[model samples]
Target: MLSHLPTNHHLRPLYRLLALASGVYVLVFGIIGVVQTSGAETFDRSGDATALGLPTNPAFAYASVAVGALIVLSALIGRNLDFYVYSVVGLVFQIVGMLALAFLGTDVNYFNFSVATCVVSLVIGLALFTAGLYSRVGARADAH
Candidate 1:
């Protein structure tokens, strides 16, 4: 699958860089969540007013940290397809979790942000997946 990619060196580097950046962002967010949860900080529940409170559960924080670390490690190892799949799954989980929180009114503002981040991550994940497909197709064509 790796051999079918096009010879365009430009796309490869761009894809790698984007993946790396996304991974780093995820890792940072995850680490922050872990720290916040470990410290037992109270998440703010105010609606778009201030982010002084913590999320309802520290479990989400821990999960975020673990997922983020996995994303970063996957990207660094050039596992683009695996990264994309994992990211999409993670984003979906986040979206559902955020929606549930919103319905429960646990923290509307925080949930809103969570939804937004999930959407953004989903888009990035889709793009990465498409890029991987393109590379695979290109590689196959080259072998013909």
Candidate 2:
């Protein structure tokens, strides 16, 4: 029972705009990640393995762009889109990223396991979870 399914609400436009912005943000970062690909580690900071000093592999760039593209698509096409689903996916990604960092922080994912990394993931996961869990859209039938 996601909100904003069938009708447009006052807040819908704002949410959609935010999604678009998020998409652009991630998309830009993704491109930057790909461009900074290098093997050697500098100050334990390897561009090939870390994007923005966050633990990442070559695949992370692609994933980020893909997520961004999805977000853009959803924002543009307002029909049959569930915002909650995307939020859940984001939440899940943060959780998985954290777990990976925890068990195999440095060696496994090549993540720095730095304070910044932990805080970033925590904030993202919490934000997504909070928004998704609290924001509810009435069923389509319930609208009219």
C-alpha lDDT (0 to 100) for residue 44 of candidate 2: 39
lDDT of 1 at 18: 64
For each of the candidates, the C-alpha root-mean-square deviation to the true structure, in angstroms, is 5.8, 4.7
Tell me the whole-model lDDT of each prediction, alpha carbons only: 0.50, 0.56
Q: How high is each candidate's TM-score? A: 0.54, 0.63
Residue-level lDDT tens digits of model 1 in 30-86: 666556545453443322321224233344555556766666666566534543544
Q: How close is candidate 2 to the true structure, as a TM-score?
A: 0.63
lDDT leader: 2
The positional error of residue 9 in candidate 1, measured at the CA in angstroms, is 7.6
- What's model 1's lDDT at 98? 49
